[model samples]
Target: MSVTGKYGGPLPKGPWAERLHEIFDRLLAAFGPQHWWPGETPFEVCVGAILTQNTNWANVSRAIKNLKEAGLLNPEALFSIPRHVLAEIIRPAGYYNVKSERILTFVAFLMQEFSGDLDAAFSLGLWDLRSRLLSLKGIGPETADSILLYAGGYPIFVVDAYTARILERHGLVGDDVSYDSIQSLFMDNLPSDPALFNEFHALLVALGKGHCRKGRPRCETCPLAGIHLNP
Candidate 1:
């Protein structure tokens, strides 16, 4: 809605695009396309977003298979299933009890507010949708952005540990920058392009996993070595 700093100036195009491209090129050269946010449908994307909290894709995949085997991956089915049953099913994903409640809460919100129509839910303006999602329990900044970026195809930059580390090290932002501030740095500077947000976030995640780790960063092999912020 507010297209001020989020979309005003010249977004990352031309030489800026080249910088992004170089980042992507080196990442792709090492890891390939990634074909991220792995899911068959948008519903699955939303579900995966919830299931992936504090877990890896492999565990999330197992949990999803559990839901699929139980025939309750859809909104109605997920909502109707007994909470304990759902928790049991998703046990493999870790934090089963809490995540079960989170999934149900989000699905209930969808059912009540949007009649379970995902497109309708997404039709709300970016800020409105994000605000509404933040009101839900367990839907923190990262989770809300993940749903917006992957599920709704909104051009909202998703920030996580990797993004914070990369940006801070690159001197692009302060160490104490809030989640919204860090995300704003990207959304303000980059074009409001869903594809770019999606790919860039995924690339940052890859970089974090491979190089910018917190405890033991591998700066020697890092592509963004010279770009480190050292703040």
Candidate 2:
């Protein structure tokens, strides 16, 4: 409801901002707080973001727990292991081999660039850090933004299938909407607070899983059920 964010910039007063704010309010009222990212440390959060590429959080949690039990959750310890062994360690997350390579590449990048100091790497400007992360072989936009926002505490919006699905179902976005478009819709229109972005994204995920499910959305019972976006 505030016209400006604590960190970002002045928000334009328009239909998009109002509608997005209303949606965020409704979701927060329905779901309260989601306490998302589900990791104790920034490194763990980054690892979860990568491992969660094609799997659920449950699977990711198992894989992370395995790493923690093995005392290899940090970048250096994880980077030290053989790829096959790393793959075996994260077997529960599905795509173990590919994810292992990705994790190694990320860790390698971290080690080589910052001596495994994530704080140092995150100290760069938003776009600079984003560009560096996107240049990695396995890190895509969503994954990169997840690390930036959730791990680095940057004010960036993260888009996922749940986000796109809910927006499209509510007539806020068209079918086949792009990741960047959805991301820009929120970033451009909303107050650029990491806490708001973080909670809003998490709440959308909750709605997607609980009501606006793919191929079987229970729209009648959804929190955004009666409110239509005036596009």
- The C-alpha TM-scores of every prediction are 0.87, 0.95
Across residues 111-177, which tens digit of lDDT does each residue of candidate 1 receive? 9999889999999999999999999999998999999989899888899988888767766667898
Query: Which residue pairs clash within candidate 1?
Result: 169-228, 169-229, 170-229, 171-229
Measured by C-alpha RMSD in angstroms, how accurate is candidate 1?
4.8
Tens digits of lDDT, candidate 2, 55-145: 8999999999999999998888977899999999999999999999999999999999999999999999999999999999999999999
Off by over 4 Å in 2: 1-9
Weakest lDDT window of 10 consecutive positions for candidate 2: 1-10
Mark the 10 consecutive residues where model 1 has the least summed lDDT. Answer: 1-10
Residue 209, model 1: lDDT of 91
